[model samples]
Target: MEGFLQLLLNGTALGSIYALIALGYTMVYGILRLINFAHGDIVMVGAYAGLFTALAVNGPAHPDLFHFFIVLLAAMAVSALLGLFIERFAYRPLRNFPRLNLLITAVGVSLLLENLGQVVFGATPRVFPDIMPSMNWFQFGQVAITNQQVTVFGTSLFLMVVLEWIVLKTKLGRAMRAVSYSHEIASLVGIPTDKIISFTFAVGSALAAAAGILVCISYPKVDPLMGVMIGLKAFVAAVLGGIGSIRGAVVGGFLMGIAESMVVGYGSSTYRDALAFAILILILLFKPAGLFGKYQPEKV
Candidate 1:
Protein backbone atom coordinates (compact mmCIF):
# COMPACT_ATOMS: atom_id res chain seq x y z
CA MET A 1 0.00 0.00 0.00
CA GLU A 2 2.83 2.40 0.82
CA GLY A 3 4.53 1.53 -2.41
CA PHE A 4 1.34 2.15 -4.31
CA LEU A 5 0.95 5.51 -2.60
CA GLN A 6 4.51 6.43 -3.47
CA LEU A 7 3.98 5.68 -7.10
CA LEU A 8 0.72 7.60 -7.11
CA LEU A 9 2.33 10.67 -5.60
CA ASN A 10 5.18 10.58 -8.03
CA GLY A 11 2.79 10.04 -10.88
CA THR A 12 0.66 13.03 -9.87
CA ALA A 13 3.70 15.24 -9.70
CA LEU A 14 4.85 14.14 -13.12
CA GLY A 15 1.34 14.54 -14.44
CA SER A 16 1.23 18.12 -13.20
CA ILE A 17 4.24 19.03 -15.29
CA TYR A 18 2.83 17.26 -18.32
CA ALA A 19 -0.46 19.06 -17.77
CA LEU A 20 1.27 22.41 -17.78
CA ILE A 21 3.02 21.66 -21.05
CA ALA A 22 -0.09 20.12 -22.52
CA LEU A 23 -2.03 23.28 -21.72
CA GLY A 24 0.22 25.20 -24.07
CA TYR A 25 -0.40 22.73 -26.87
CA THR A 26 -4.15 22.73 -26.39
CA MET A 27 -4.37 26.50 -26.08
CA VAL A 28 -2.50 27.17 -29.30
CA TYR A 29 -4.46 24.53 -31.16
CA GLY A 30 -7.73 25.79 -29.74
CA ILE A 31 -7.15 29.34 -30.90
CA LEU A 32 -5.41 28.83 -34.22
CA ARG A 33 -6.15 25.26 -35.22
CA LEU A 34 -2.49 25.28 -36.14
CA ILE A 35 -0.16 22.97 -34.27
CA ASN A 36 2.82 24.98 -33.19
CA PHE A 37 5.51 22.38 -33.37
CA ALA A 38 7.92 24.79 -31.73
CA HIS A 39 5.87 25.07 -28.59
CA GLY A 40 8.09 22.61 -26.73
CA ASP A 41 11.15 24.72 -27.38
CA ILE A 42 9.65 27.33 -25.13
CA VAL A 43 10.22 24.89 -22.25
CA MET A 44 13.87 24.63 -23.12
CA VAL A 45 14.18 28.38 -23.29
CA GLY A 46 12.47 28.74 -19.92
CA ALA A 47 14.70 26.21 -18.23
CA TYR A 48 17.80 27.95 -19.49
CA ALA A 49 16.45 31.33 -18.54
CA GLY A 50 15.75 30.14 -15.04
CA LEU A 51 19.14 28.51 -14.74
CA PHE A 52 20.94 31.63 -15.93
CA THR A 53 18.93 33.92 -13.72
CA ALA A 54 19.55 31.78 -10.67
CA LEU A 55 23.27 31.52 -11.39
CA ALA A 56 23.58 35.21 -11.96
CA VAL A 57 21.90 35.96 -8.67
CA ASN A 58 23.62 33.41 -6.51
CA GLY A 59 26.12 31.22 -8.28
CA PRO A 60 26.32 27.56 -7.16
CA ALA A 61 24.60 28.25 -3.86
CA HIS A 62 21.20 26.71 -3.37
CA PRO A 63 18.65 29.51 -3.54
CA ASP A 64 15.84 30.08 -1.15
CA LEU A 65 12.21 29.70 -2.15
CA PHE A 66 11.95 33.43 -2.79
CA HIS A 67 14.95 33.41 -5.07
CA PHE A 68 13.51 30.50 -6.97
CA PHE A 69 10.26 32.39 -7.31
CA ILE A 70 12.15 35.27 -8.88
CA VAL A 71 13.83 32.88 -11.27
CA LEU A 72 10.50 31.32 -12.17
CA LEU A 73 8.96 34.71 -12.91
CA ALA A 74 11.95 35.67 -14.98
CA ALA A 75 11.72 32.49 -17.02
CA MET A 76 8.02 33.04 -17.63
CA ALA A 77 8.69 36.57 -18.81
CA VAL A 78 11.45 35.54 -21.16
CA SER A 79 9.45 32.68 -22.59
CA ALA A 80 6.42 34.91 -22.99
CA LEU A 81 8.44 37.44 -24.95
CA LEU A 82 9.90 34.69 -27.08
CA GLY A 83 6.42 33.41 -27.72
CA LEU A 84 5.26 36.83 -28.83
CA PHE A 85 8.29 37.19 -31.03
CA ILE A 86 7.67 33.87 -32.76
CA GLU A 87 4.02 34.61 -33.36
CA ARG A 88 4.72 38.06 -34.73
CA PHE A 89 7.69 37.30 -36.92
CA ALA A 90 7.13 33.70 -38.00
CA TYR A 91 3.40 33.02 -37.83
CA ARG A 92 1.72 36.39 -38.25
CA PRO A 93 2.75 37.10 -41.84
CA LEU A 94 1.63 33.64 -42.91
CA ARG A 95 -1.80 33.95 -41.38
CA ASN A 96 -3.67 33.69 -44.64
CA PHE A 97 -1.43 31.00 -46.12
CA PRO A 98 -2.41 27.38 -46.30
CA ARG A 99 -2.39 25.56 -42.97
CA LEU A 100 -0.01 23.06 -44.51
CA ASN A 101 2.33 25.97 -45.08
CA LEU A 102 1.89 27.07 -41.51
CA LEU A 103 2.53 23.56 -40.27
CA ILE A 104 5.72 23.36 -42.30
CA THR A 105 6.77 26.77 -41.05
CA ALA A 106 6.17 25.66 -37.47
CA VAL A 107 8.42 22.67 -38.03
CA GLY A 108 11.05 24.96 -39.51
CA VAL A 109 10.83 27.29 -36.54
CA SER A 110 11.15 24.35 -34.13
CA LEU A 111 14.28 23.12 -35.90
CA LEU A 112 15.66 26.65 -35.97
CA LEU A 113 15.12 27.03 -32.24
CA GLU A 114 16.76 23.71 -31.44
CA ASN A 115 19.78 24.36 -33.67
CA LEU A 116 20.10 27.91 -32.44
CA GLY A 117 19.86 26.68 -28.88
CA GLN A 118 22.66 24.20 -29.50
CA VAL A 119 24.80 26.95 -31.01
CA VAL A 120 24.08 29.31 -28.14
CA PHE A 121 23.67 26.97 -25.19
CA GLY A 122 25.79 24.08 -26.53
CA ALA A 123 24.83 20.50 -27.22
CA THR A 124 26.12 19.22 -23.90
CA PRO A 125 23.48 18.76 -21.26
CA ARG A 126 23.88 20.98 -18.23
CA VAL A 127 22.86 20.11 -14.70
CA PHE A 128 20.29 22.61 -13.54
CA PRO A 129 21.59 24.48 -10.52
CA ASP A 130 19.75 23.70 -7.35
CA ILE A 131 17.52 26.74 -7.15
CA MET A 132 15.64 25.65 -4.05
CA PRO A 133 17.12 23.94 -1.08
CA SER A 134 16.04 20.34 -1.02
CA MET A 135 14.45 18.86 2.11
CA ASN A 136 11.90 16.26 2.98
CA TRP A 137 8.62 17.85 3.87
CA PHE A 138 6.95 14.71 5.19
CA GLN A 139 7.08 10.92 5.13
CA PHE A 140 4.37 8.37 5.56
CA GLY A 141 5.56 4.78 5.59
CA GLN A 142 7.32 4.32 2.24
CA VAL A 143 5.78 7.44 0.77
CA ALA A 144 8.06 10.35 1.34
CA ILE A 145 7.22 13.84 0.07
CA THR A 146 9.77 16.53 -0.62
CA ASN A 147 9.56 20.29 -0.78
CA GLN A 148 10.23 20.12 -4.51
CA GLN A 149 7.23 17.87 -5.12
CA VAL A 150 5.01 20.14 -3.09
CA THR A 151 6.21 23.19 -4.92
CA VAL A 152 5.78 21.62 -8.32
CA PHE A 153 2.33 20.27 -7.57
CA GLY A 154 1.10 23.43 -5.88
CA THR A 155 2.43 25.82 -8.49
CA SER A 156 1.12 23.78 -11.37
CA LEU A 157 -2.32 23.54 -9.83
CA PHE A 158 -2.39 27.24 -9.10
CA LEU A 159 -1.42 28.10 -12.64
CA MET A 160 -3.98 25.70 -14.01
CA VAL A 161 -6.68 27.35 -11.93
CA VAL A 162 -5.66 30.81 -13.05
CA LEU A 163 -5.64 29.66 -16.66
CA GLU A 164 -9.08 28.16 -16.26
CA TRP A 165 -10.43 31.36 -14.82
CA ILE A 166 -8.92 33.41 -17.59
CA VAL A 167 -10.34 31.17 -20.30
CA LEU A 168 -13.78 30.91 -18.77
CA LYS A 169 -14.51 34.19 -17.02
CA THR A 170 -12.48 37.15 -18.18
CA LYS A 171 -12.99 39.53 -21.11
CA LEU A 172 -9.83 38.30 -22.77
CA GLY A 173 -11.09 34.81 -22.30
CA ARG A 174 -14.29 35.72 -24.07
CA ALA A 175 -12.29 37.17 -26.93
CA MET A 176 -10.23 34.02 -27.17
CA ARG A 177 -13.32 31.88 -27.20
CA ALA A 178 -14.85 34.06 -29.86
CA VAL A 179 -11.80 33.81 -32.05
CA SER A 180 -11.49 30.10 -31.53
CA TYR A 181 -15.09 29.60 -32.46
CA SER A 182 -14.77 31.55 -35.70
CA HIS A 183 -11.88 33.80 -36.60
CA GLU A 184 -13.79 35.42 -39.42
CA ILE A 185 -16.79 36.06 -37.26
CA ALA A 186 -14.66 37.34 -34.43
CA SER A 187 -12.91 39.70 -36.80
CA LEU A 188 -16.25 40.83 -38.19
CA VAL A 189 -17.45 41.45 -34.66
CA GLY A 190 -14.54 43.89 -34.21
CA ILE A 191 -12.46 41.61 -32.00
CA PRO A 192 -8.78 41.91 -32.72
CA THR A 193 -8.17 38.34 -33.74
CA ASP A 194 -4.48 38.82 -34.30
CA LYS A 195 -3.99 40.30 -30.88
CA ILE A 196 -6.04 37.52 -29.35
CA ILE A 197 -3.92 34.93 -31.07
CA SER A 198 -0.78 36.64 -29.85
CA PHE A 199 -2.12 36.72 -26.33
CA THR A 200 -2.89 33.02 -26.54
CA PHE A 201 0.65 32.29 -27.61
CA ALA A 202 2.06 34.39 -24.84
CA VAL A 203 -0.03 32.66 -22.22
CA GLY A 204 0.71 29.22 -23.54
CA SER A 205 4.42 29.86 -23.79
CA ALA A 206 4.50 31.22 -20.28
CA LEU A 207 2.88 28.04 -19.06
CA ALA A 208 5.45 26.00 -20.94
CA ALA A 209 8.22 27.96 -19.30
CA ALA A 210 6.74 27.34 -15.89
CA ALA A 211 6.54 23.66 -16.68
CA GLY A 212 10.18 23.68 -17.72
CA ILE A 213 11.32 25.20 -14.47
CA LEU A 214 9.14 22.90 -12.42
CA VAL A 215 10.40 19.81 -14.19
CA CYS A 216 13.98 20.93 -13.67
CA ILE A 217 13.32 20.90 -9.96
CA SER A 218 12.59 17.21 -10.18
CA TYR A 219 14.91 16.11 -12.98
CA PRO A 220 17.65 18.70 -12.39
CA LYS A 221 19.00 18.92 -15.91
CA VAL A 222 18.58 20.77 -19.18
CA ASP A 223 19.58 20.36 -22.82
CA PRO A 224 18.86 21.99 -26.16
CA LEU A 225 17.02 18.92 -27.43
CA MET A 226 15.20 18.25 -24.15
CA GLY A 227 11.97 19.70 -25.43
CA VAL A 228 11.67 17.41 -28.41
CA MET A 229 10.40 14.30 -26.63
CA ILE A 230 8.56 16.24 -23.97
CA GLY A 231 6.83 18.29 -26.59
CA LEU A 232 5.75 15.12 -28.38
CA LYS A 233 4.38 13.65 -25.18
CA ALA A 234 2.57 16.84 -24.34
CA PHE A 235 1.13 16.89 -27.84
CA VAL A 236 -0.11 13.39 -27.28
CA ALA A 237 -1.61 14.50 -23.99
CA ALA A 238 -3.46 17.35 -25.68
CA VAL A 239 -4.81 15.08 -28.40
CA LEU A 240 -5.79 12.42 -25.89
CA GLY A 241 -7.62 14.96 -23.78
CA GLY A 242 -9.26 16.23 -26.94
CA ILE A 243 -7.30 19.03 -28.48
CA GLY A 244 -8.83 22.48 -28.06
CA SER A 245 -10.31 21.60 -24.69
CA ILE A 246 -8.47 23.09 -21.74
CA ARG A 247 -9.80 20.71 -19.12
CA GLY A 248 -9.20 17.85 -21.48
CA ALA A 249 -5.52 18.69 -21.78
CA VAL A 250 -5.14 18.61 -18.02
CA VAL A 251 -6.98 15.31 -17.81
CA GLY A 252 -4.92 13.73 -20.54
CA GLY A 253 -1.67 14.88 -19.01
CA PHE A 254 -2.44 13.39 -15.62
CA LEU A 255 -3.56 10.15 -17.19
CA MET A 256 -0.43 9.92 -19.28
CA GLY A 257 1.76 10.75 -16.32
CA ILE A 258 0.11 8.15 -14.11
CA ALA A 259 0.32 5.56 -16.82
CA GLU A 260 3.98 6.29 -17.43
CA SER A 261 4.73 6.18 -13.72
CA MET A 262 2.97 2.85 -13.37
CA VAL A 263 4.93 1.43 -16.25
CA VAL A 264 8.17 2.61 -14.70
CA GLY A 265 7.19 1.46 -11.25
CA TYR A 266 6.00 -2.02 -12.08
CA GLY A 267 7.09 -2.83 -15.60
CA SER A 268 10.17 -2.20 -17.70
CA SER A 269 11.29 1.41 -17.71
CA THR A 270 12.68 0.81 -21.22
CA TYR A 271 9.20 1.01 -22.68
CA ARG A 272 8.20 4.18 -20.81
CA ASP A 273 8.52 6.52 -23.74
CA ALA A 274 6.94 3.98 -26.02
CA LEU A 275 3.79 4.05 -23.90
CA ALA A 276 2.98 7.60 -25.03
CA PHE A 277 3.09 6.64 -28.69
CA ALA A 278 1.19 3.48 -27.99
CA ILE A 279 -1.53 5.39 -26.21
CA LEU A 280 -1.66 7.92 -29.03
CA ILE A 281 -2.09 5.20 -31.64
CA LEU A 282 -4.78 3.48 -29.67
CA ILE A 283 -6.66 6.73 -29.11
CA LEU A 284 -6.41 7.65 -32.76
CA LEU A 285 -7.68 4.28 -33.82
CA PHE A 286 -10.46 3.89 -31.28
CA LYS A 287 -11.51 7.51 -30.69
CA PRO A 288 -9.75 10.00 -32.89
CA ALA A 289 -11.68 12.90 -31.39
CA GLY A 290 -10.24 11.92 -27.99
CA LEU A 291 -11.92 11.12 -24.70
CA PHE A 292 -13.37 14.57 -24.21
CA GLY A 293 -13.14 16.09 -27.67
CA LYS A 294 -16.25 16.91 -29.61
CA TYR A 295 -16.31 16.08 -33.29
CA GLN A 296 -16.96 18.89 -35.73
CA PRO A 297 -17.41 18.20 -39.41
CA GLU A 298 -15.82 20.87 -41.56
CA LYS A 299 -18.12 22.33 -44.19
CA VAL A 300 -16.75 21.53 -47.60
Candidate 2:
Protein backbone atom coordinates (compact mmCIF):
# COMPACT_ATOMS: atom_id res chain seq x y z
CA MET A 1 0.00 0.00 0.00
CA GLU A 2 2.83 2.36 0.80
CA GLY A 3 4.55 1.46 -2.45
CA PHE A 4 1.32 2.13 -4.31
CA LEU A 5 1.06 5.55 -2.71
CA GLN A 6 4.63 6.36 -3.70
CA LEU A 7 3.91 5.35 -7.26
CA LEU A 8 0.80 7.50 -7.25
CA LEU A 9 2.62 10.63 -6.14
CA ASN A 10 5.48 10.02 -8.54
CA GLY A 11 3.03 9.40 -11.35
CA THR A 12 1.15 12.56 -10.53
CA ALA A 13 4.35 14.56 -10.78
CA LEU A 14 5.19 12.98 -14.14
CA GLY A 15 1.66 13.56 -15.30
CA SER A 16 1.89 17.22 -14.38
CA ILE A 17 4.90 17.67 -16.64
CA TYR A 18 3.20 15.78 -19.44
CA ALA A 19 0.10 17.85 -18.88
CA LEU A 20 2.05 21.05 -19.27
CA ILE A 21 3.66 19.95 -22.55
CA ALA A 22 0.41 18.39 -23.74
CA LEU A 23 -1.37 21.69 -23.16
CA GLY A 24 0.98 23.29 -25.65
CA TYR A 25 0.14 20.58 -28.20
CA THR A 26 -3.59 20.85 -27.60
CA MET A 27 -3.63 24.67 -27.70
CA VAL A 28 -1.87 24.78 -31.06
CA TYR A 29 -4.09 22.03 -32.42
CA GLY A 30 -7.22 23.80 -31.18
CA ILE A 31 -6.49 27.07 -32.94
CA LEU A 32 -4.83 25.97 -36.18
CA ARG A 33 -5.73 22.30 -36.61
CA LEU A 34 -2.03 21.92 -37.29
CA ILE A 35 -0.03 19.23 -35.44
CA ASN A 36 3.08 21.40 -35.18
CA PHE A 37 5.39 18.38 -34.98
CA ALA A 38 8.16 20.89 -34.32
CA HIS A 39 6.44 21.70 -31.03
CA GLY A 40 8.55 19.09 -29.19
CA ASP A 41 11.74 20.55 -30.60
CA ILE A 42 10.72 23.86 -29.09
CA VAL A 43 10.75 22.14 -25.73
CA MET A 44 14.27 20.92 -26.49
CA VAL A 45 15.36 24.47 -27.25
CA GLY A 46 13.88 25.62 -23.96
CA ALA A 47 15.89 22.99 -22.09
CA TYR A 48 19.03 24.36 -23.72
CA ALA A 49 17.97 27.79 -22.47
CA GLY A 50 17.57 26.44 -18.95
CA LEU A 51 20.90 24.57 -19.07
CA PHE A 52 22.63 27.80 -20.07
CA THR A 53 20.72 29.53 -17.30
CA ALA A 54 22.02 27.02 -14.76
CA LEU A 55 25.56 27.40 -16.00
CA ALA A 56 25.45 31.17 -16.01
CA VAL A 57 23.84 31.84 -12.66
CA ASN A 58 24.31 28.77 -10.45
CA GLY A 59 27.67 27.86 -11.86
CA PRO A 60 30.52 30.37 -11.55
CA ALA A 61 28.24 33.42 -11.42
CA HIS A 62 26.55 32.69 -8.05
CA PRO A 63 22.83 31.88 -7.79
CA ASP A 64 19.89 34.32 -7.61
CA LEU A 65 16.14 34.03 -8.25
CA PHE A 66 16.21 37.20 -10.34
CA HIS A 67 18.72 35.62 -12.68
CA PHE A 68 16.70 32.40 -12.69
CA PHE A 69 13.50 34.21 -13.69
CA ILE A 70 15.37 36.11 -16.38
CA VAL A 71 16.63 32.88 -17.91
CA LEU A 72 13.16 31.38 -17.67
CA LEU A 73 11.61 34.41 -19.33
CA ALA A 74 14.26 34.42 -22.03
CA ALA A 75 13.64 30.75 -22.76
CA MET A 76 9.87 31.22 -22.98
CA ALA A 77 10.12 34.44 -24.98
CA VAL A 78 12.49 32.97 -27.51
CA SER A 79 10.28 29.90 -27.94
CA ALA A 80 7.09 31.99 -28.34
CA LEU A 81 8.69 34.31 -30.86
CA LEU A 82 10.02 31.35 -32.81
CA GLY A 83 6.57 29.80 -32.84
CA LEU A 84 5.17 33.05 -34.22
CA PHE A 85 7.87 33.14 -36.85
CA ILE A 86 7.21 29.53 -37.89
CA GLU A 87 3.52 30.26 -38.31
CA ARG A 88 4.31 33.27 -40.45
CA PHE A 89 7.12 31.95 -42.59
CA ALA A 90 6.55 28.22 -42.88
CA TYR A 91 2.80 27.84 -42.51
CA ARG A 92 1.17 31.11 -43.62
CA PRO A 93 1.88 30.57 -47.31
CA LEU A 94 0.44 27.06 -47.15
CA ARG A 95 -2.69 28.15 -45.32
CA ASN A 96 -4.83 27.86 -48.43
CA PHE A 97 -3.14 24.72 -49.66
CA PRO A 98 -4.11 21.15 -48.89
CA ARG A 99 -3.83 20.02 -45.27
CA LEU A 100 -1.28 17.46 -46.44
CA ASN A 101 1.01 20.27 -47.53
CA LEU A 102 0.78 21.79 -44.11
CA LEU A 103 1.33 18.43 -42.46
CA ILE A 104 4.45 17.83 -44.53
CA THR A 105 5.62 21.32 -43.68
CA ALA A 106 5.11 20.61 -40.00
CA VAL A 107 7.27 17.50 -40.27
CA GLY A 108 9.86 19.54 -42.09
CA VAL A 109 9.80 22.19 -39.42
CA SER A 110 10.16 19.56 -36.72
CA LEU A 111 13.18 18.07 -38.43
CA LEU A 112 14.69 21.48 -39.06
CA LEU A 113 14.33 22.52 -35.47
CA GLU A 114 15.76 19.26 -34.16
CA ASN A 115 18.77 19.50 -36.44
CA LEU A 116 19.22 23.20 -35.72
CA GLY A 117 19.20 22.48 -32.03
CA GLN A 118 21.74 19.73 -32.51
CA VAL A 119 23.98 22.14 -34.42
CA VAL A 120 23.63 25.03 -32.00
CA PHE A 121 23.30 23.33 -28.63
CA GLY A 122 25.49 20.39 -29.63
CA ALA A 123 24.72 16.74 -29.01
CA THR A 124 26.26 16.73 -25.55
CA PRO A 125 24.09 16.34 -22.47
CA ARG A 126 24.04 19.32 -20.10
CA VAL A 127 23.10 19.47 -16.41
CA PHE A 128 20.59 21.87 -14.93
CA PRO A 129 21.20 23.68 -11.62
CA ASP A 130 19.65 22.61 -8.32
CA ILE A 131 16.90 25.18 -7.90
CA MET A 132 14.88 23.35 -5.27
CA PRO A 133 16.23 22.40 -1.85
CA SER A 134 16.05 18.78 -0.68
CA MET A 135 13.58 19.36 2.12
CA ASN A 136 10.57 17.06 2.31
CA TRP A 137 7.28 18.83 2.86
CA PHE A 138 5.64 15.95 4.71
CA GLN A 139 5.95 12.18 4.70
CA PHE A 140 3.01 9.89 4.19
CA GLY A 141 3.64 6.54 5.87
CA GLN A 142 6.94 5.32 4.33
CA VAL A 143 6.95 7.45 1.18
CA ALA A 144 9.36 10.33 0.71
CA ILE A 145 9.33 13.22 -1.80
CA THR A 146 11.62 16.20 -2.20
CA ASN A 147 10.98 19.92 -2.70
CA GLN A 148 11.73 19.51 -6.42
CA GLN A 149 8.71 17.32 -6.96
CA VAL A 150 6.51 19.78 -5.12
CA THR A 151 7.90 22.68 -7.12
CA VAL A 152 7.38 20.91 -10.46
CA PHE A 153 3.82 19.92 -9.65
CA GLY A 154 2.94 23.29 -8.11
CA THR A 155 4.36 25.40 -10.92
CA SER A 156 2.79 23.26 -13.64
CA LEU A 157 -0.63 23.48 -11.97
CA PHE A 158 -0.33 27.26 -11.63
CA LEU A 159 0.45 27.62 -15.33
CA MET A 160 -2.42 25.33 -16.26
CA VAL A 161 -4.80 27.39 -14.14
CA VAL A 162 -3.63 30.65 -15.69
CA LEU A 163 -4.04 29.22 -19.22
CA GLU A 164 -7.47 27.77 -18.51
CA TRP A 165 -8.67 31.10 -17.13
CA ILE A 166 -7.32 32.99 -20.12
CA VAL A 167 -9.00 30.68 -22.61
CA LEU A 168 -12.37 30.63 -20.88
CA LYS A 169 -12.58 34.35 -20.01
CA THR A 170 -10.60 36.82 -22.10
CA LYS A 171 -11.79 38.61 -25.27
CA LEU A 172 -8.76 37.32 -27.08
CA GLY A 173 -9.76 33.87 -25.99
CA ARG A 174 -13.19 34.37 -27.53
CA ALA A 175 -11.56 35.58 -30.72
CA MET A 176 -9.36 32.51 -30.71
CA ARG A 177 -12.39 30.31 -30.28
CA ALA A 178 -14.08 32.12 -33.12
CA VAL A 179 -11.16 31.66 -35.45
CA SER A 180 -10.77 28.04 -34.48
CA TYR A 181 -14.40 27.15 -35.01
CA SER A 182 -14.45 28.73 -38.45
CA HIS A 183 -11.82 31.07 -39.83
CA GLU A 184 -14.04 32.38 -42.61
CA ILE A 185 -16.81 33.25 -40.19
CA ALA A 186 -14.39 34.73 -37.65
CA SER A 187 -12.85 36.90 -40.39
CA LEU A 188 -16.34 37.85 -41.59
CA VAL A 189 -17.11 38.97 -38.05
CA GLY A 190 -14.05 41.34 -38.23
CA ILE A 191 -11.68 39.13 -36.30
CA PRO A 192 -8.05 39.11 -37.32
CA THR A 193 -7.74 35.40 -38.04
CA ASP A 194 -4.08 35.62 -38.98
CA LYS A 195 -3.20 37.45 -35.81
CA ILE A 196 -5.21 35.03 -33.71
CA ILE A 197 -3.30 32.11 -35.20
CA SER A 198 -0.01 33.83 -34.44
CA PHE A 199 -1.10 34.44 -30.86
CA THR A 200 -2.06 30.80 -30.47
CA PHE A 201 1.39 29.62 -31.55
CA ALA A 202 3.05 32.08 -29.19
CA VAL A 203 0.95 30.94 -26.26
CA GLY A 204 1.52 27.27 -27.05
CA SER A 205 5.27 27.79 -27.39
CA ALA A 206 5.48 29.57 -24.04
CA LEU A 207 3.72 26.69 -22.36
CA ALA A 208 6.07 24.23 -24.01
CA ALA A 209 9.00 26.29 -22.72
CA ALA A 210 7.76 26.07 -19.16
CA ALA A 211 7.27 22.33 -19.55
CA GLY A 212 10.86 22.04 -20.74
CA ILE A 213 12.16 23.83 -17.68
CA LEU A 214 10.09 21.71 -15.32
CA VAL A 215 11.13 18.48 -16.97
CA CYS A 216 14.74 19.55 -16.62
CA ILE A 217 14.23 19.95 -12.88
CA SER A 218 12.59 16.55 -12.65
CA TYR A 219 15.15 14.62 -14.72
CA PRO A 220 18.12 17.01 -14.45
CA LYS A 221 19.37 16.31 -17.94
CA VAL A 222 19.16 18.18 -21.25
CA ASP A 223 20.09 17.10 -24.75
CA PRO A 224 18.99 17.65 -28.36
CA LEU A 225 16.76 14.61 -28.30
CA MET A 226 15.34 15.30 -24.85
CA GLY A 227 11.99 16.53 -26.13
CA VAL A 228 11.24 13.52 -28.32
CA MET A 229 9.58 11.25 -25.75
CA ILE A 230 7.91 14.10 -23.90
CA GLY A 231 6.64 15.53 -27.18
CA LEU A 232 5.33 12.18 -28.35
CA LYS A 233 3.73 11.58 -24.96
CA ALA A 234 2.24 15.08 -25.02
CA PHE A 235 0.85 14.50 -28.52
CA VAL A 236 -0.76 11.36 -27.26
CA ALA A 237 -2.21 13.28 -24.34
CA ALA A 238 -3.72 15.83 -26.72
CA VAL A 239 -5.21 13.05 -28.79
CA LEU A 240 -6.64 11.34 -25.73
CA GLY A 241 -8.26 14.58 -24.54
CA GLY A 242 -9.73 15.45 -27.91
CA ILE A 243 -7.15 17.35 -29.85
CA GLY A 244 -8.87 20.72 -29.65
CA SER A 245 -10.08 20.54 -26.07
CA ILE A 246 -8.04 22.49 -23.50
CA ARG A 247 -9.56 20.71 -20.51
CA GLY A 248 -8.93 17.45 -22.30
CA ALA A 249 -5.23 18.22 -22.50
CA VAL A 250 -4.93 18.54 -18.72
CA VAL A 251 -6.99 15.42 -18.09
CA GLY A 252 -5.13 13.38 -20.67
CA GLY A 253 -1.75 14.57 -19.42
CA PHE A 254 -2.30 13.54 -15.81
CA LEU A 255 -3.89 10.26 -16.81
CA MET A 256 -1.12 9.32 -19.23
CA GLY A 257 1.52 10.26 -16.66
CA ILE A 258 0.05 8.01 -13.98
CA ALA A 259 -0.43 5.20 -16.43
CA GLU A 260 3.18 5.40 -17.58
CA SER A 261 4.49 5.51 -14.05
CA MET A 262 2.48 2.47 -13.03
CA VAL A 263 3.94 0.55 -15.94
CA VAL A 264 7.45 1.43 -14.89
CA GLY A 265 6.74 0.59 -11.27
CA TYR A 266 5.23 -2.83 -11.91
CA GLY A 267 7.12 -4.01 -14.98
CA SER A 268 10.46 -3.52 -16.70
CA SER A 269 11.27 0.18 -16.95
CA THR A 270 12.58 -0.49 -20.46
CA TYR A 271 9.09 -1.43 -21.61
CA ARG A 272 7.58 1.67 -20.06
CA ASP A 273 7.21 3.44 -23.40
CA ALA A 274 5.69 0.45 -25.09
CA LEU A 275 3.17 0.26 -22.27
CA ALA A 276 2.17 3.88 -22.85
CA PHE A 277 1.57 3.28 -26.55
CA ALA A 278 -0.30 0.07 -25.85
CA ILE A 279 -2.68 2.00 -23.66
CA LEU A 280 -2.93 4.77 -26.22
CA ILE A 281 -3.83 2.20 -28.83
CA LEU A 282 -6.57 0.83 -26.62
CA ILE A 283 -7.95 4.30 -26.06
CA LEU A 284 -7.86 5.06 -29.78
CA LEU A 285 -9.66 1.86 -30.69
CA PHE A 286 -12.28 2.11 -27.96
CA LYS A 287 -12.88 5.87 -27.86
CA PRO A 288 -11.53 7.50 -30.98
CA ALA A 289 -12.35 11.01 -29.83
CA GLY A 290 -10.52 10.51 -26.53
CA LEU A 291 -11.89 11.14 -23.03
CA PHE A 292 -12.57 14.85 -23.58
CA GLY A 293 -12.80 14.94 -27.37
CA LYS A 294 -16.10 14.83 -29.25
CA TYR A 295 -16.75 12.86 -32.40
CA GLN A 296 -17.51 15.19 -35.26
CA PRO A 297 -19.23 14.15 -38.47
CA GLU A 298 -16.96 14.15 -41.48
CA LYS A 299 -17.57 17.01 -43.89
CA VAL A 300 -17.31 16.26 -47.58
Name the Cα RMSD for model 2.
1.6
* RMSD, candidate 1, Å: 1.0
**Residue-wise C-alpha lDDT for candidate 2, range 77-166, written one tens digit per residue:** 888988899999999999999989999999999888888878987888877776555578878778978676887788889889888788
| Candidate 2 segments whose C-alpha is farther than 4 A from its true place | 59-68
Residues forming the 10-long window of minimal summed lDDT in candidate 2: 59-68
Q: Largest lDDT belongs to which candidate?
A: 1
TM-score of 1: 0.98
Deviation in Å, model 2, residue 129 alpha carbon: 1.9
Model 2 C-alpha lDDT versus the unseen true structure = 0.84
Q: lDDT of each model, Cα atoms only? A: 0.93, 0.84
